[model samples]
Target: MDSEKAVPGDGVVVRAIRAGEWGQARRLRLEALRDPVAELAFLESYEAAAAKPDAHWREWTAGAAEGTRDRQQFIAETAGGEWVGSVTVLLERAGTVDPFGGTVACDQGHVVGVFVGPAYRGDGAGVTRALFDAALEWAWAADVERVRLYVHERNTRAEAFYRKAGFVASGVRATGPAGVGGFELEYEMKRSA
Candidate 1:
């Protein structure tokens, strides 16, 4: 399905992940997890993520395609049909708390699992930026006051990208499990005035 098309340096389409696109999602996700820097950004291992049941993949893709009370996922595809990048957004309810140890003071969205294949990195075809623009537009259209994401302390590249896209550090740090020591830094971008 044609969701949204972006004319980055090259033509790329940023669209919602369709129902049957689970297999494609699985493939891209595995490829992302295998990237050398995956350990610094993604929480799941390639082996574990690749082994998830088809039902799980179906559910994940369906929710992102149609959107639910809490989540959505969007994909970036090159004109040649190559899956190049992805981003997922999770809505956090007011007064509730998130899994990363933050209380939801206002209705907001959390962007996660952002990745772009190395080939497309730094091209500024606007593929990745367009994905965030679409996601934030959706969240703000839903009356969300802000959108936030957490980046690993070691992921300076991601941190720089987010900042360039208008996010600022929230000065909040979350510690992961012992094996994954080091804090995750919180960054937020509120709807512009």
Candidate 2:
């Protein structure tokens, strides 16, 4: 698969994660889990992620970073070679069950693990946008009908950005386990044929 495409501005380039870069991916994920909004932005806790074995991390990266048709992870890197953000997309097919235990009813892409570091968030940075663009581009190229993501109802920052990026609330609501404040809303953006 072709990788390493440059974003239009700010010298941030979006690229596919390669095999053997599991350590880097793990570090970035742990960093994302440390963000102030991490509790709402991600389902996994920093402690949980930190406790995972190296083999687990490697397998995780290998599955998404290997350019498999089922999923892909894209990262935004600066000119100085720092990874600032990431977004991952998983392609679901009809008849296949999703991580959420829902039966896949159509060919679609589920966007997940989206994040941009504190230093990279702001006007004109474009790290998050670039990462999303790359993932959506991959989804469209694969002919998926739509891309969908679930955002914690309290995470207004992510909701607004997703709306600005053309995603609309699909009226799908999910409640997490009883102790977690239980409310996430699904948003989706469809591909134009």
Which numbered prediction scores highest in lDDT against the true structure?
2
Determine which window of 10 residues in candidate 1 has minimal summed lDDT: 1-10
Give the range where candidate 2 is weakest over 10 consecutive residues by summed lDDT. 173-182
List model 2 lDDT by residue over 1-193, tens digit each.
Answer: 3588776767888898987889989999999999988888888899999999999988888988856788999998889989889999999887899777889888999999999988778657777787888899999888888899999988999999999889999998888534568688999998886
Predict model 2's lDDT versus the native. Answer: 0.87
State TM-scores per candidate: 0.93, 0.94
User: Predicted candidate 2: what Cα RMSD to the true structure?
Assistant: 1.5
Q: Can you tell me which runs of candidate 2 are displaced by over 4 Å? A: none
Candidate 2 to truth, TM: 0.94
Candidate 1, superposed: residue stretches over 4 Å from native: 67-69
